[model samples]
Target chain A: MPEGPTLAQLGEGELIRRLGAFAPPGQFDDDAALLGAALLGGRPAGDPPLVLNTDVLVEDVHFSAATMGAADVGWRAAAANLSDLAAMGCRGAVGLTVALVAPGHTPWAWVEGAYAGMAELLGSHGGVLLGGDCSGGRQRLLAVTALGRLPAGGGPIRRGDGRPGDVLVSTGAHGISRLGLAVLRGEALPDLPAAGRERAIRAHRRPVPRFDAVAALGASRPAALDWRVAGCDSSDGLATAASCLAVASRCTALLSRSDLPLAAELAGQAQAEDWCLWGGEDFELVLALEPAWAEALVEQLEGARWIGRLVEPQPWGPLGWTEGGGPIASPTAAFRHFG
Target chain B: MPEGPTLAQLGEGELIRRLGAFAPPGQFDDDAALLGAALLGGRPAGDPPLVLNTDVLVEDVHFSAATMGAADVGWRAAAANLSDLAAMGCRGAVGLTVALVAPGHTPWAWVEGAYAGMAELLGSHGGVLLGGDCSGGRQRLLAVTALGRLPAGGGPIRRGDGRPGDVLVSTGAHGISRLGLAVLRGEALPDLPAAGRERAIRAHRRPVPRFDAVAALGASRPAALDWRVAGCDSSDGLATAASCLAVASRCTALLSRSDLPLAAELAGQAQAEDWCLWGGEDFELVLALEPAWAEALVEQLEGARWIGRLVEPQPWGPLGWTEGGGPIASPTAAFRHFG
Candidate 1:
């Protein structure tokens, strides 16, 4: 577009050839295009139906950059929030990355490693870096926007899709990450006889995103529920996710207090309630299924477990504690930022 | 999306129901979408034509978090990057945000201010925040990726678009931001005229994106030449921009040094050469056109002047300093950065 006899090289009023070169992942588009960099003192695109979501991660709140590897920081920076798109049943199209660099040069190796890690992650997934801004400051923060496609006819899996007696299932085991965090923080002992410390550690290191499993399930099975944003990752604890989901879903879940899955270390730390209910960063697929299909679905997924069923939303009571599991509220008070 | 359902409440299959409620955007799209988060893990929607650009701004590299208000930081962050998007004639569809938080707590007021600022900019422009990552970090850094459209059939605008006999025109005047920066630095300005200070400061503090202007110029007039990715930013200084543009454009520009516009105070501060070619952050539109259309375009853009015409590219003299006016070699010696 810029290399040819368009714009200045040609005269005004002459038909500028269409910029059909930069191919993006949006199949809906027909040609390649030229990108105008950041707002360059110009008019904006016309209003269109758009989706928006923003996330802010604070040190200690999200990750300790000091303790975390640079590459891990990069990977997590993109993956954590990207999971939201998947949960929304939206296909990611492009990425808008903003990295607020911290003061002092981050080692070239570290910076490149982080970018390399993120690039590898983004590349393997079919995403392109559209354009973004970079700056330095007190802390290193990253804001990434994942532009995605709404499945053509396929709708997004929304929170209001659960049916009465829908059997609850999760894509994989849970509580390991929370336990891993506890182990890392020295709050729990993974040194116990049954503790699989290595497994717990791996769980914390590189969390996997469930785009595949979710997409396959969406396309092949088409989770026929009324909502589309379906089956996204559950990195946070089950209870935390449930609290918000319950309100939107307008349903309650009752997990058999004893049936939730947990690693042996987590089970041992059950007394601390640091594993199953409150512990987070699980990053698994938690699902709601029709009661009729529960057994077969569980059978189909070897590692999956039926935790509870969706009931009516409750004003009070355990939403998943024991078939009456309502929500989690620490006695002395819910989880606080500080000790 | 999180507000409606718990993972357990609605299983993975219900995405269709939720997403179907919304309409898809016009243009390109494919079913295979970017599936994962780390380095592009999702399926492809199929490649569509589009434009892309990115930039990063930090608290210090771009602005001092200490003195600059959070709202200003946020406004500038989006605006500065949006400028890149505008340069390419791209429309912002989605964004990826990575905010590395500082130690302890940065007030919610600050966060709100930042989002409010960005929101105001994005809302007016018609873009959205899809999903991004957040983490704790040492210093603040922002990286943004912008995705845009190019009339359904646009090509990459490279620097090599200009040709000999082309006219030079910009959307607006130059050197205001430099003046603003000088003001911010509180430089001795007994000789500095007062008229240009406020405007320059505003230009530096908030650079409105040039997307609309570029689009309008490209659409209505259809640029005679492109020189897009091929060209750099005003932050790099007009001289460097001209040099690189002319070189890539494979042409030389006989710019009439006298005709170039400069803010009054800026003209008084230093050598006119600095303001003419080396001054930075002007955010003005620069054009090279055939002589015939130059007059018409000049009429279209009131403030523009006959800078110079294009000639064959030279290894050292893209800007025809030997022919007459312009500075030697000074494009800010590259933008300053702490890292």
Candidate 2:
């Protein structure tokens, strides 16, 4: 008999690794797989490639109906899918398809609110809910499909494209959504300001994708396989995403602890760094760019900050955290699906 | 207080109708909405428009774990989405996105089999799984999004395009899948042949989409706002789909009782017509075309059969059943999500 850890013990990453062997080569390793890489025939040059992604939110797994509203559920699901487009630096989302499964007794207002939330977010981002399916189920579930066009000139920025000396950058704050979830889940903590709690809750409930920020980079032309930048959405914690980038690019990611941008509301929190490292669901982009272009690119985008740098693979590890002098213990904590 | 029927009583279609008011006009009424109907700017003329559709399947509601295998679940879900594209006469499917949510205790083999089934079906249909999200949930659920391309030099044939003089046609047999399900569920029967039962079970377990049959019609040119045909997938029962088309096109559907192509296994079954009318999940295309073109279309496509005709709206109803003599009773039964 075979002896091995179960899926929960093996974790989401391991399961993905095992499943990767069955998928088309080099396709399922990124935030979203590129379609038509070999099938887009007769399409005119300059036609933007279509980038598609899907996300599912289960009632208890992703959000508890006891705490989160239906509108928030819809908004968060859309945001998750949109973040994948941002990871690829797609021009903007053009359309979305959704499937909703819930009990027969579920309120109509809840569903209406869900659609309103989807429409509101997509409209603001220049996208729309084009079509969807709804079915009755024992539990509430929402699945969203987002479709976007790749930038006219630039191809997708993949995790495997990071060079040895690329500067690691990120957009927006980290660990905020996780902190917000803690607040919403009623995890008791030291005396905290009511305003801070509200802010954190809002952050966890509503995340904005960095599509506009990445769209700005689309002006860069693709020539001879040289990309201006490479990255993926850091929804699965900074450490996990960075480690994945490291493994894919065959480089070491030396992430800086002091350079981390903690959420404003998480000040004085003891495990703030821990959350920043492995508290996933941040929906921020962890980008890698040439050191020479980092400063100029940061200047062009808002809320963009440099956090670390990619270097030659070290024998010790592929991921490392450093403060000032030397690398400290690497954090193994990450939000895995089964875990 | 202002009240009529709640979502559960009004059912899925009514809820969609009420919610459709909030969507872009006529967009939510079709199998797949056209994204660039008003936004296709700078896009070359002859480029095929993208067709998108979504379907969700949940445990207990869609299938029972005891009866259905994981692969069957995945294959059935994909077929549902692909059938939507076939309803629109899309040239062919190109890509798909899926979301799977299941508990940690679920067997890893089940997940692998699910993927294998999806890959096998999509590959045979000229499509590939692009990307998807997987998470841990209380109940196993699957959602699929299918993306296809509209045929070159042709526009989509919408359900609302049916004319009063049009003949109603369907690809393949109806009620066969429902009979198959009954067999799988071990419903008591009148000593039906084992071979016939096996065939019905296969139909229910592995339904195919009519993409090729519809693609053949797209070769016909679109001129002066006239179209070759209009229809939708009969996942909601033939009666329900026919009624929807009649409502959309402002015509009455006059269905012929003897014209229905029932499965050979149900030849002597007294309840065969009931299953054909109300037992949904057939995944067959129910098309409406002009009388002049129906003959040619049947000749071009295998297993194509004429089922009914459209007539001017009568005072009594928008859908009617008739045989060699007087009008028969209309079927009020439909497979509703929340019914």
TM-scores for all predictions? 0.73, 0.92
Best by lDDT: 2
Candidate 2 chain A minimal-lDDT segment of 10 residues: A217-226
Estimate, for each residue in B205-246, the C-alpha lDDT of model 1 and write its tens digit: 776766555554444344554332233345556766666668
DockQ of each: 0.17, 0.52
The candidate that achieves the highest DockQ relative to the unseen native structure: 2
lDDT of 1 by residue, A203-261 (tens): 77556655564555444442444332323356656665554345446677666666676
**Candidate 2 on A257-309: residue-level lDDT in tens?**
77886877778888788888788889888888886566655777777788899
Tell me the TM-score of model 1.
0.73
Give chain B TM-scores in order: 0.73, 0.91
Model 2's CAPRI class is medium
RMSD of 2: 3.1
